[model samples]
Target: MSRTVPYQPVLLRLLHSAIALLVFGSLITGFMVYDRYDKRFGTLNLPIIRDTQGIHGTIALAFLCLLPLFAIYCFHIGDRRLIQKESFKQLQEVGKPIWWISLQRFANSLLLVSATFAVITGRMMQEEWLPTGEFNHVWYIGHLIGWLLMFVSVAIHLLMSAKVGGLPLLLSIYNWKIRPEDMPKFWLRGFKLKPSTTFLFFFEAVVIGGIAIAFILPLIFTSPQ
Candidate 1:
């Protein structure tokens, strides 16, 4: 008889599934909006959606609202696998190459930062600005940058996941074989504060706070009112 791989906790699977769906939806709709509105960077041959902005906005709102819950889960429970202190400690082994799991953690961290930046800058964008070809607006610029970062970050994340654990690990989150012990109720225990949790909090705050300040401060200083 073959041994079954360990099952992901119900809460973690649910949250990860929701986040993955939202991220993909946001990316598709956001690109459609960009293709329709801005061509300075060149345009794709994809079909132009007349209401891309509306679709994108709806997806963005959903993503923005749900992201906090996901963040909470990540900060509270997901940080253990995410922080990868063992990987960092391996840095001392000068001749040893970093493991795929370590690279995966780093990629995941970048994805979180990129997602937060995309959501913040996206919220600051107005529909009128995009339709009027007002691509030069500060928030729009930030949104564009965030979009690029998100695209790259997601690509890296997917690649790293594939390299680290292959299809089984990737599919584990979607598996329906949750054991009796893997119920959602027990997931909270993973959130206990370890030394690594502090590092995760600080990393997220810096990425999010730094981007917010960079874009928001300019508006505050330049406002005519």
Candidate 2:
């Protein structure tokens, strides 16, 4: 008996891989910045990197830039992987395979929400605040909590995916073999924005607009002051 490996779309793999790398970089550099500045929880004995904050911000900005495209793809094309209208009802079927699948979908949705939370809060943060010993800002606290939630969400996401799809499913995202239909050249041909996803696309647009405003407002207020 052989385990079956499911095929993943090449665009999904590319977007997922890029986002994963950016998230991982942001997490490590975020910790380094935290350790360098505010260590109320406990400090690491690592050598200080003066530019960790800047590096973290750069990675975060990259994540922000990529998020809208990823969100659009996920909501429109990969919507099945996210929580559905029947998800909650399916949860009542505990111990059934559908229960696990529903749980995985919920976890997948949570990852998106938490990632957005972390990114928005991060965009609202000021680089100088932590270095200047201002550790209690509401945005900073929210950012810290957001990242913590995102870390937990990521773990839950992996566990749920493993539970639902097993190792083969886990490896599917990294599968490099692309079906002829999923080729980049044919993507536009198959891509149809369904009316059902209109609301989601609008919500994503609002979030992206909010992020842009968050990124721009500080500069506007602080300029030449």
* Among all candidates shown, the one with the greatest TM-score: 2
Scored by CA lDDT, what does every candidate get? 0.74, 0.80
In candidate 1, how many Å is residue 37 off? 1.4
Candidate 1 lDDT over residue span 1-225, tens digit each: 112454688888888898889889988888888888787898896787778888888887787777777766666677755656566875455443356567777788778788887876776676788787778887889888988998898898888777666777778889977677676567676564533555776875665565555456546655311
Off by over 4 Å in 1: 1-6, 84-98, 193-197, 207-225
TM-score, predicted candidate 1 vs. hidden true structure: 0.82
lDDT of 2 by residue, 34-131 (tens): 88889998888569987889889999999988988887787777878877777889999999999999999889888877787788678778778998
Q: Which stretch of 10 consecutive residues in model 1 shows the poorest summed lDDT? A: 216-225
Cα displacement (angstroms), candidate 1, residue 129, comes to: 0.9
